[model samples]
Target: MLKVDGLTKKFGELVAVNSLNFEVKEGQIYGIAGPNGAGKSTVYNLITGNYRYEGRIEFDGQDITGLPPYRIAKKGIARTFQVPEIFPSLNVQETIRVGSRFGARGGLDKKHSDEVLNFVGLEEERLQHAGLLNLLGKKKLMVGAALATKPKILMLDEPMAGSNAGEIADLMDLIKKINQQLGITVIIIEHFMKVLTELTETLLIIESGRMICCDRPEIVTSDPRVIESYLGDSYAEDK
Candidate 1:
């Protein structure tokens, strides 16, 4: 479980994240969404220790606010960027092996690395160059590499960003498997309303770095303020 209380991040005069507060229950698929400048990604950065902010971030009841990124990762938190980040020259197997070396909760387990490769459905491409993969393959590889870190919570940023409908569906299934089968708590920042509504039990909507709504997907998608702010009036009218 993770709790963020009064989390505020300011870039000089611009307040990117303002007093944001939320809690992620264990084994829950939590959803976060906002417009482009809503500081959605900043919240992730704050949680993962990429930025220093004025708030408290507690993971598993321990305060980890000022910890560095590597320390946070070793504390059982792993994340994937919006774009697939991989070692171009490294083969798929080697990429995962690197994560295994610096894994959370354990250290350099070859068996676990192999399992993660299979878990992310990249066993066939284990020896292939990471940079040579297609869009879907690259995405899977990034997720696989993160999995090799053996995290208790997986924070994904815009995992569906460049995917088609079918690819979105595939990612959805994979996320479900990661949560249901692996029992990992998930916190995903995404733009697709369908993905959030279908996959998340609780959705957190923000606007200009402040909380607009935090509730069930059905309640969030129907709220008038949410429609006015992000979903648009037409979406509400159609509903």
Candidate 2:
């Protein structure tokens, strides 16, 4: 479980996150959504210790606010960036193995690396250079690498970005398996309302770095503030 309270982040003159608070229970798929520059990703940064911020972040009841990223990761938190980041020169298997070195509770293991490669459906491409993979393949590889860390919670940033409908569906299925079969708590930052509504148990909407509403995805999507801030009137009517 993860808990964030009074989280605030400032970059010189601009406030990126303002007193944000949310809780992600164990085994739940929590979601976050906001328009561009709404500080959705900034919250992840603050939680993962990318920057110093005002507030407390607790993972499984331990304070993790100011810890460095590696330490946080070692405490069972793993994350993927908005863009798929892969080692261009490393083979797919090697790329995943490198991530295997960062397991939250123990040192790397080859069997776990193999399991991650297969879990993400990249077994056949394990020998290929990472730079050669297509967009979807690269995304899967990135997720596989994150899985290699054996995290209890995986924070995904726009995992559906730049994907076609089919790709989005594929990612949705994969995410489900990760939560169900792998039993990992998930916190996803996404702009796609349909994905959030369909996949998340709880959704949090924010604007100007503050919460607009936090509730069940269905309720959050229907909230007037959420509709006004991100989902347009037409989209709201369809929902």
lDDT of 1: 0.93
Candidate 1 Cα errors over 4 Å, as ranges: none
**Worst ten-residue run, lDDT, model 1?**
100-109
Give the per-residue lDDT digits (tens) of candidate 2, residues 1-239. Answer: 89999999999999989999889999999999998999988898888888999999999989998999899989989889899998999999999998889764678788999999999999999899999999999999988988899999999999999999999999999999999999999999999888998999999999989999999998888888888888989986775
Worst 10 residues of 2 by lDDT: 102-111
TM value for model 2: 0.98
Clashes found in each candidate (C-alpha, N, C closer than 3 A): 0, 0
lDDT of predicted model 2: 0.92
- Could you give me the TM-score of model 1 versus the true structure? 0.98
| Model 1: per-residue Cα lDDT over 1-239, one tens digit each | 89999999999999999999999999999999988999999999989899889999999989998999999999999999998889999999999988878764668888999999998888999999999999999999899888889999999999999899999999999999999999999999999999999999999999989999999999999998999999998888787
Per-residue error at 236 for model 1, in Å? 1.5
* Model 2 vs truth, CA RMSD: 0.9
- Cα RMSD for candidates in order: 0.9, 0.9
Model 1 lDDT, residue 141, Cα: 88
